[model samples]
Target: MKRSDESTYSWLHRLNPDPYSLAVNAALLELVPPGLRLLHYTRTTVPAEHLGAFAFYHRKIGPFHLDGIPEPMQREMMFVIWRIIELGGRVPCAPMGLLMRELAETTQRLKTAGLPFQSLTDRTPAQWKAELSRTWVKRTHAFPNPQTFRTYVSPLDRACKILWFTYDTSPWWQREVWDLTMDPRIPRRTQEPSGQKAIHWHTMEPAWLRHGGMYFVKSMMESSQLAWSTAHGAKNALVQFARFAMARGLTSPRLVQDDRQLRGLMMEFLTELRSTPNYGIRNRDKPRSPASIGQITSTVRAFYAFMHDYGDEAAAALDDDRWDGLSPEYLRFWRPGDIGSSKKEHFDESYLYSDADLAKIKAAAPLLGLPRAEGGFGDPQAMRILLLMMTTGRRINEICMLDARPLTLLEDNLAKLRYQQTKIHDAPDTIFVDQEVIELIQEQQAWLHAHLATIGADADPPYLFVSRHNNLRGQNPYLTHVFRTQLTKLVDRAHLTDAAGDPLDLGKTHRFRHTKATSLFNAGVPLHVVQRYMGHTTPEMTMHYAQTLDSTAKTEFLKYKKITSTATESAVDAEDLYDLMLLDTRTDRVLPNGWCTLPPAKTCEKGNACLTCDLFATDERFLDIHKSELVSLDSLIDQRQEIHRERTGEPMSENHVWLTLRRREQQALSTIVKNLETGGSKPAAALPAPATQAREQAGMLGGQGVRTGHRP
Candidate 1:
């Protein structure tokens, strides 16, 4: 037995690792394969990574025997290490710990065999080749991730010291080799790495650690996320938020997610959901998807509260601690996977029309038996409904809920539209109608009056924006289903499109509201002004009206913010943004050589200045303004890709889509952490257990608009 306690065995434990001439290193010129099929480590971190003597040095060479590493692999490995050094790992993934495990096991086996091997050092190059040919090599292909295996390395620390190398040559084939080497010798001039040599890695940074409770919290939350509440709905929301989060290039946001914090939050919510008295929930009568119910309510409420804090003073005023330490009993749950009991028959967007599309539709109404805007006032009435949407930007439901009888036009042309409906239904929000919108409403009323005699003025629906029931009013009703039917007929008959004949998007009626918000801002109206136009009692709801159109709208939108532009090619320079972020990079974070490509490089493949690169970096500005804090942005990108893979199961494209996807992912993760801290996840041990966590992991994000994805 290789006595672990003996001081001489210290090197064996650290470098050699195995006594069996295991595949990692070797004993008597033999390799150790994955022979311990039954053994498992408890409470042990995988691969013994991220700790102890290895933390500072953090990399290793081998008890290096040359068998497992094929000859072709060496050169390639060297080259990769060189690039890793140059790139500072902006490349994202460098699964080093996994690679080192393969090296360690192979080395241990070869060493334990204790065989006297031919010395390649003394032999001629041909002799070395001959001996290599004569030697028997047993190929045991490594695990996909060789780093998962772990050993009881120590009492306080179980992480193993993994090797890392930066080499040059074929980056593809020698990826494993480079993953194993120390840092290569970097040349000073352009800061390139030396060829074919491996030195110790000097990252001089701490390895990412989410230990013990932290790891457990992540595991539990991730596991339960999709299963809780509405699984599928949450999944979609997660995708949206995750994409955004990954694009946000900051580590500070990541620190907020710690283990104990979230575990406690989750535990509390789950416990409360199944509390002894059920927290006075009235609708516990209906069957529910147990896995998601508890966590989803917890998560959403937590997020709403968190966001409410970040909102303006008015929002803060509405926030209530009255339900202090009280878990919100679930009121309603949209079934997971499917978007409720019915399909998307009524929620279709056809009732919505853009301003231009509505104009075209209005023009065509005369041909379809609907009155033209000029004569009988049939099409004109429809026009009034559209103008209302454009002015108020109210959702289709909100618009339908309005009873115009309560609205009175003042001499100033201001329409005082009052209604007691669900605008933050928990509280009362007064609606203020703008003047231009009031005029449109008056036009709609005149059209209605003309049509009222034909359709029976007293027969229209209670809702102001009645759809299929078009002119049916006073007592008769029009449900959303009517809107769908009428909308389908209108779209089919109108044949609306842009002048180029590209079919205009007309399915969404709510878009009139979106259009109102978007158009008002594009016309140089302030967001707050757009907000009042929408009748949002609070600024938070008002902000939702904000948007930037692709190109034209952006140029015009800036004017509202009082930001003047000279029509320069750059609307907002990407380099300028990077410089601001890099203005204060993390302490001791290392940056790569091409930190800013503008300083000029020694004539390589694509040596154009950063601004001209496909992604377009103003490299000179990046260096000049942010040279003091050039962090290797590799990790952020890596985390982004990884989360993307986890959520969408699709790799991102190379274009700026990568940035878009990453930013969302990072934000979702940030939201999760915040919910964990103030919401639940803490005191996880005390909570009443709910369904499995796997559901919540996949399906908890977005609010009432989102769907939950979990099922039995």
Candidate 2:
């Protein structure tokens, strides 16, 4: 082959065929018995390297993956397909749909008719064969000839029955039979049922099934691009709504078609939900919390809205003309006041870890990986998760879902954690983590490698925290329940509790996040710094996590109160004094006699000669401070006066300018002392400088405008 052809062939070869793909080919081929010819199928690919690759058959819904179908299921489905093709029976247009509907109706009839119901279990082989033939001919009208009936229909019916029996009483088996029989041409990735299995449409009342409960789930999951969990929840919620309707004798969708009727139903459901006890026996006596009630109601409201938008198909199928009057606007106006805030505030100190509690946790962390013989039944994964939680302040899911590949260790032991944000899908790609967190992750890496080795080299664990259990191998550690259980044990073993003597509530792993964020905040970490550390997109979220401590609040309040009370005066209130204190020129420039009331913009002409100025006003608050400064000034003046006497050889006061300055300061200090002795009743009151005494003396002596600039 040419190089171009080879490249095309390689691309074609990469298109790994699944059972459904094989089954679709088998159905399409009009060849002879067993139709093994389809098994020799090859893909056709484009030659261009830039264009990537394409295949001959992509399923209707979306393109299938290389290993979309599990090997075991693929083999079983292929065998069924081959056998059908060998029987020379033409494939039906909607093969799976017809087969499942026929099987469902047949099963329903068999139960209704009350045939020798135990005949299959008790009867002879011939009798069983006869019964199978009778049921196939009676129920399924697809069989073309008698030969095909015996060869094709009889065996297909038997296989369906056997599958139903083998799975015991699972209603999903009916769908399973359909799945096996059909080509499953949907070109999408395999969607597994997450959380709980969806309630089968057969179990629900006819109204729900007809009015788009199951159809909605299938459409949203397959076509509308809803996630498996979301689709599953909607399906479950609709099922519960159906059950509620059935109990109230409101079997059909039309009964609650209007907004008013639907709202009434919604109110009734919510009221009953509020009174209903929790599911688990431990909390069985306790009524469902407001948050839980809100979720249930919201789910139902969502269902109603969905039905309103797409219920046209369902309404058209309705036998009654009232559907024309039915507004697809059910529960649009129904308001259930904010359910998220119904519980206690998120900022509870009881949930946070104290220094002592943290120390206990730190000690207990290592005990998780100890052998069971040494009284440790905990997984190392749990310990690592807790460590990450305490240090990173990230949500448990965010840490759990962290990709092993994105744990990049840079120089200086700094590391970056790259992850797809689980809560808000469009959040940042990476957040910087501390070295200690990187170390814990490194330990997890070692554990993961060892785990994969034990599980065999073919096994892949995508996440940082992976389960090593036989059943949940290669999956995330069961943090939802298992991790919490382990943490609770650690808490109990460590005897960790609060100042209130209450045992630590490991109930919320989120407490670790709050504790970490609050700790950073309490340590005076900047809001932006805490935000980045906690992987919060906004500082507000980090602030929310940083719950205020009552002790911190009280201490800060007392400090503020003391400042205010000391500054308050009978003439000037605390607010006025506070404003005055904020003025730029209200500093230590004032003389010991009084504080300077100089405007900040003005330059003082008498810079160092503040003692002679009248712009000064003294407050008792700074009296001691001023007295200390005065003592230092007097000591400096004596030293300068001695130097003046040695240099000039004359009385220092009469000859030196420095002695004159010291005398002026001494005079101001004496006036302050005398005023303080007389005005001892007032505390922290501003007093004028005694430059006024000199001004009074000058006025009496000269009787001219005493050019002293003294306000006093």
Local distance difference test values of all predictions, in order:
0.34, 0.50
For model 1, how does the per-residue alpha-carbon lDDT over 425-464 read when each residue is reduced to its tens digit? 2333345676776666565555545555554444343445
Q: Which portions of model 2 show Cα errors greater than 4 Å? A: 1-211, 217-240, 257-266, 273-285, 313-325, 328-347, 373-375, 471-479, 523-543, 546-712
TM-score of each: 0.30, 0.52
Whole-model lDDT for model 1 versus the true structure? 0.34
Candidate with top TM-score is 2
Model 2: worst 10 consecutive residues (lDDT sum) = 557-566
lDDT of 2: 0.50
Q: What would the C-alpha RMSD of candidate 2 be, to one decimal place?
A: 17.8
TM-score of 1: 0.30
- In model 1, the number of clashes is 136
- Give one digit per residue, the lDDT tens place, for model 2 in 1-712: 1123222222222221111233333333343233232222223221222111122233441121212223332333334433333222222213322233333444445667885332122332234445445667775554335664343233334333322222223222123211211222322222221122223344456554434554455555556455444554565556656766777887555566455666666667666666666654466668877665656667666655666666666456443333344474563535646234455355444556777777867877888887778888648888888887787777766676676665877777798887645443344557687788778888988888887666443255556676453222354333456678887887788677766677877767887877777777766677788777666687666667554543333322222211111122224343443445336455433233333455567767875555465555454433454455456666766666677679888646544575666677667755654454455444342222213333233323122211222333
